[model samples]
Target: MADLVIADVTVNKKASVYFDGKCISHGVTFPDGTKKSVGVILPASLTFNTGAPEIMEIVDGACKVRLKGTEEWVAYAAGSEFKVPGDSSFDIEVSETVHYVCHFG
Candidate 1:
């Protein structure tokens, strides 16, 4: 799949500085008030709780994710995506660098 280009947005460099700074991201906000973060996760295992529904697009590499209420972890590679419901927590295991773009809605 081709790369995504989101036009007319602002970036917040300080966003997504979690997991002892292992996962870093910059927040992107669009003209319509939509928000997302384009970031990369280094090899690590982390869990995140979402305030809103998140659609995580795997832009490069891959990661194994166990969504809220799921017992199995699923692998998502580049050009693939997954969703996590609002107010839910999910676990992600990255064996390699994984590039992702997370859309919050």
Candidate 2:
């Protein structure tokens, strides 16, 4: 499980909105220079490309994800997580409003 509270991190004031506002996120930087994004995806099917390896932590709601080169769609709910390889893409089908924290490396 991810931490409920992250202290002393820098938060970007502006949000990154995508898919015509169906997805929105705010970037955060930790003291150690680690980067992450806290975001929400509304009920929609969307494809996302990743620049860096990422672990998508589900904070609330549920989603089904199909990674690049994979045909299976795996279901994930709150308290679950899925990893995406760098430079890869994934298709996501959101059944509910998904609140997530994306850890990047």
Candidate 3:
């Protein structure tokens, strides 16, 4: 069996939550450590607080990505992979929705 496991998502009052799966929280094992992630997006308008270094690929439709201190963000259509760092906050003006990945240590 794989020694490393993906822990079940938990709900705690002190932590900020985005929808459900996507969030910037602590590592399950390393409680004091920060673990940020972006699970799945919905058709609804979405705003993001930049969490960590991420690698995202467009699964369907389209999305607009931007960071706070950046000049501009790149847009992408389906089957596109975009990398977002876990530094500043950003917004996603999505057409249908965008599913991305994020990580921090």
- Using all chains and alpha carbons, the TM-scores for the candidates as numbered come to 0.92, 0.96, 0.51
lDDT leaderboard ranking:
2, 1, 3
Which regions in candidate 1 have their CA more than 4 angstroms from the true location?
A: none
Superposition TM-score, candidate 2 onto the true structure: 0.96
- Runs of candidate 3 exceeding 4 Å displacement: 1-38, 71-73, 100-105
lDDT (Cα, tens digit) per residue for candidate 1, span 1-105: 657776789988577688888788999998878888999899999998999999999989878999989899999999999999999999999987898999888
Task: Return the clash pairs for model 1, or none.
Answer: none
lDDT of 1 at 46: 92
Tens-place lDDT digits, model 2, residues 24-98: 999999999999999999999999999999999999999999999999999999999999999999999999999
**How much RMSD separates candidate 1 from the native structure?**
1.3
For candidate 3, the per-residue lDDT at 26 reads: 29
Top candidate by lDDT: 2
Q: Candidate 2: misplaced stretches above 4 Å?
A: none
Candidate 3, residue 16: CA error in Å? Answer: 10
Clashes of each: 0, 0, 2
Alpha carbon lDDT at 37, candidate 3: 45
Full-model lDDT, candidate 1: 0.89
Which order, best to worst by TM-score?
Answer: 2, 1, 3
